[model samples]
Target: MWQHLSSLRARLSLLLVAAGMVGGLILAGVTHWPLPQLLAWLHGGMGQDAAAPTPVTATATTAASVPMSPQDLYVVLAVGLVLLVLAAIWLAGRALDPVSRLLRALEGAVASYRDGDFSFSIAANRRDELGKLIRMHNELGHTLREQRQHLAQRELLLDTVVQNTPVALVLTDASGRVAYANIASRHLFNEGRSLAGLDFAELLAEAPQVLRQAVESGEDALLTVDMDGSDETFHLSQRAFRLQGRPHRLHSFRRMTRELSRQEVATWKRVIRVISHELNNSLAPISSLAHSGAELARRGDVDRLPGVFATIGERARHLHGFIAGYASFAKLPAPRPVAVEWAGFLEGLSLHCRYRLASAAPERAGWFDAAQIEQVLINLIKNAHEAGGPDDEVTLSIHDGGNETRVEVSDRGPGMSETVLAQALLPFYSTKRAGTGLGLALAREIIEAHGGRVLLANREGGGLRVTLLLPTAKAPPRG
Candidate 1:
């Protein structure tokens, strides 16, 4: 009778009948002796106050004399208890049906949620507290589902950005071991090998100073490190941050060598074209002039001879100067770095240039060959002046760019077209009628020799901005 108590209905029925039987026994025992029986027993036990007793026969109540023994009483009580238990079980099953359904729904919903499926919803059949709770649980599932989807999409977008960016991206754990690497980082720092599972220190072995402070003390720093003897120079931006519940450092490397090389090649091609065109022009005229003077002298018509010689001399000098410029460009020597103050440098530039110069120089000095760097600066300034209108201002600004010195020369001239800007540094590709097209090209060569680069871009409103980046003494010197 007590075995199947798992159901709420069974347990309630069992408890109810057991309580009724216990109460009935207590009440029966208390009133078992009536007033007369109790008084008689007391009289016999106390042995007191008996007046002359009348001879009266004791009589029992009609109900007490009925044909009933202790067995009959037991049987009747058992029958009643069984009936009560059955009735109680039936009522409890009906009353607790809603609770049973809710429990089943909870079980199923939890199972679905565990499997990452949030579509399961518990039904709210009754307008009661349980119904409201069920509705809230369903809403929770929907909200969680939406949030999960949004988070996944965001993670995908972040991964795409990290993978596709040209700057090398490296993620390392608190122990400074590589945890993740983007494609650019793998190609740049890992010798095209996968960067995962490798130690960051191993990759930076030759250049441990690249992120020494950051690795040891979780500091932020900018570093220039060369990897695998590639001509490229990478500026490493490193810092510590939290990722995946643990501390990690992110290293982003931006390569600048390839860009500079492309600029240099374009400059050389332009130079060749300009040299060819100018040489052909000067040589053709000189050849014709020489022939004309010879034929005229043979015919005894020598009155124009002085003019012819003068013309020939002028053409020869022009050609000589053009060729000499080409030779100088071709024979550019390696830079001999020296320390120079910005004020003195700007003063010397002022004497050479007629355009008004604006200036901002860094407090710390630069490590560069003064003459070669001055050549580059002079070329850029001249280009800026020519690109701007007569009234336009030529501005020179310099800033300490962490690991390098950034110098910008901006002018207010009409900006170059895409086609012109793309090939502006090529030798023969010049907009001016008499331009050799070697100015920017030669400047690039010199700056590159000093382990720097030239960047030419159009100004926001109009005109051109030429930028030069030179490594400072603090930065590891480049080739």
Candidate 2:
């Protein structure tokens, strides 16, 4: 209690009491005089007669009879001091009210900053020191909010670039742990798996040496990597810099496989078109001459004309077959679908193309242009036979794929290499010297036209497998 007596509240109370005493003294001094005497003094200053002393004498005699004691004066002073003390307390609370409100606002702003929120700000309207302090804090909050917004925009732009770009990007920390990976990185390097916190070395396990050298050196390096059993080349770019005061690496991988494949296919198509045009121009005259010579020989010249006609006829037939192969591939017709039973279709396929059936046909039927699909199957079966030995039997199987029917033709031939299979369906890409490379291409075009797909790959048992996927004839189940 004694310690608190010297506190601000206590000191303020004492000062209030002291002020009351000083005010009491001033009031006492002014009021203790006879009222009549004071009134007469005022009248005397107004030029009234000396007879005004009569009222002063009466008032003086009355005050003399009721003179106040020291104790009475002390009582009045004490009462005035108590009123002043109460007034001081009321005034003190009013003054401290604003302080409490300002303190709360300050505390809230500080907490918001700690929580990474800079949107809240204090509004100070008063022209005082505390108001000035609030305005300064509000300025700081505004600056922080602007900075937060700027940073968010930058982060959004970076994520968009990283995820949407065709190039694969991998970001790592100083210790080579993966910190960030873009969508392409997940696809090409991680097989669509999470890359965060994974070791950089493990993420690039497919081409560890290539990636390591690229990361260590601050330069772009072009390298070829084996992906999906094919050698795919990529242009790699690397840069090392500090992020948030820590060293980091950004590695970019751009694939060149599609671009190179496009260029190669474009060149081949141009060459094939040129050769086909020139051959057609020369074939018409040769066919006409051969037919004229054959007619002449059949008419009468039977000595050397018989052998000449036979040679010309043989050459013309070969030429016709060669030209027909190119023309049929180049001028494929759209599918005109007709419902065909699987059993009859397989019988026709076997009789025409000599493909031995390996698996029994499923009960389901197929809907496709019989002629176009037959051509697809015949080409596949013929290629299978030609690719294999004379005794090797090409096997045919049918798989009911619910939505699509899969017809697989397997041959026990020397299987194509990884590189060859990748380009097998490309036009003018063939293993055989005499092949126009149009068989697989035409098959693909026909299958795709029917809203189906064609896939060619090596079979598991050392042979080539050609799969033709066509839409099934069966209706879909109602949802």
Candidate 3:
């Protein structure tokens, strides 16, 4: 029964009943009993000595007919009201004690949640509104705990990936202190020691000269470092970003020596195969033609001898050209940069291979090896013409950007696919059966020698565009 009445509503109802009963008893005493007898009864009921004599033999009608004086009525009424108010206050405090404690618990739980602690939960012992509220708070705590666990797991997985990756990653704060460093970075910079909280500049000061130079440059670069008597190549990249309203920088170093070695081996193998195939094509025919010519000479057939000899000569010339192509690529010389005028250079290039001027030629002179650049343009223009486009549609445009010259050779023809475009600049890689594949590769070698770059892209609608970016002449100079 106590458990059932533990709720605030039940406790309050019982309090109301008790107050009503007390009020009823007081009213009966004041209306039916005389004032003297009433006071005597009140004093006797309170376990105190009666100040007035008790009317033991008095009749019930006489006691009922006695009227209470105004002063006596006021005293009785005042005492009754005071007693009632005290009883109500005591009952209210008893009924609301648990509620005050529950409110304090809720405030404490909220504070815990704000502090990112989700382990605390309120006990839900009753089934009242406050009890239901406690259960909901517990549920909220449970949900928050689950989400926090999932987030923690995700962060751990991310840390594992970053730590185990082969690329060395380092993050530095705006004050040049190391904020984070992965396992690879630790090994690379500190011989497997932790790098956190160290000065980034101090760490770099102890690093290899090549690595120090690359980092100091603040530019993405490929550098080679001699380590344990073996040269290792690494590509370094740096990026700056804001985190938590503060600037930070991330530096990543990826070792590229192994990848480069693999590519070099593959390139050598391809070169050997191409050379063997070209040699067999030329030598096999030449041998057959020589045997045929000898057989005709044995029969005194001189007319066919000349034809066979001419065929052999043509095969020899083709073989010579093929061999020379490889030799030129292998022995590419350093560029001799010189001042070059646009009109004269373009005219000379046009004489070798035709192209329409798509944009007005720039007036400023460019700095590069004119002979080498002319050869590259000739090869490109010839390719544009042979791309199955109309001869007139082979267009060349030159733009004079601030510090560089952009020469674009575009053709309206079927463009190269992604796969083809990717490997087109590689030596001995070609789509045409008769192509030596040295044209584009040699062009790249020459342009790079001139401190320039070659870019290839498909034109918007249909066709290909080859852009050559060359440094412009800052002043007139000779090779």
Best by lDDT: 3
The count of backbone overlaps in candidate 2 is 0
lDDT of 2 by residue, 1-479 (tens): 76567344566577667666766654554446443344435545554454454555555544324444565456546655665566667656755776789999989989999999999888767555566778898999999999999999999998898798899899999999989998998887777898899898765566557666765677897778766678888898888899999999998889988998898789677657746754665576567767777787778656766666666566667667767877877677767777788899888876787767878888866788888888888888888888864434688888888888888988888989999889888776677855667789888888888878888888776788899888875333111
Among these predicted structures, which one has the highest TM-score?
Answer: 3
- For model 3, the superposed segments whose C-alpha errors exceed 4 Å read 1-110, 118-147, 473-479
lDDT of 1 by residue, 266-320 (tens): 8667666777789899989999999999999999998989999999999999999
TM-scores, all candidates, are: 0.53, 0.43, 0.73
Instruction: List residue ranges in candidate 2 displaced over 4 A.
Output: 1-270, 273-306, 389-392, 473-479
What residue pairs are clashing in model 2? Answer: none
Pick the winner on TM-score between candidates 1 and 3. Answer: 3
Q: After superposition, how far is residue 13 of candidate 2 from its true place, in Å?
A: 53
Per-residue lDDT of model 3, residues 1-479, tens digit only: 76667666786788778778877776665555454577645545554354455575643554334455677678877876776687678767767777888989989998998899999999768776678788998999999999999999999999999999999999999999999999999999899999999999999898888899899899999999988899999999999999999999999999999999999999999989888989999999999999999999999999889899999999999999999989988888777887888999988887888889999878888888888899899999999988998888899999999888999999999989999999999999999988889999999888877777899999988899999988775443222
- Stretches of candidate 1 above 4 Å error? 1-111, 114-274, 360-366, 398-404, 418-434, 474-479
RMSD of each: 11.1, 21.2, 6.6
Please identify which of the two predictions, 1 or 2, would achieve the higher lDDT against the true structure: 2
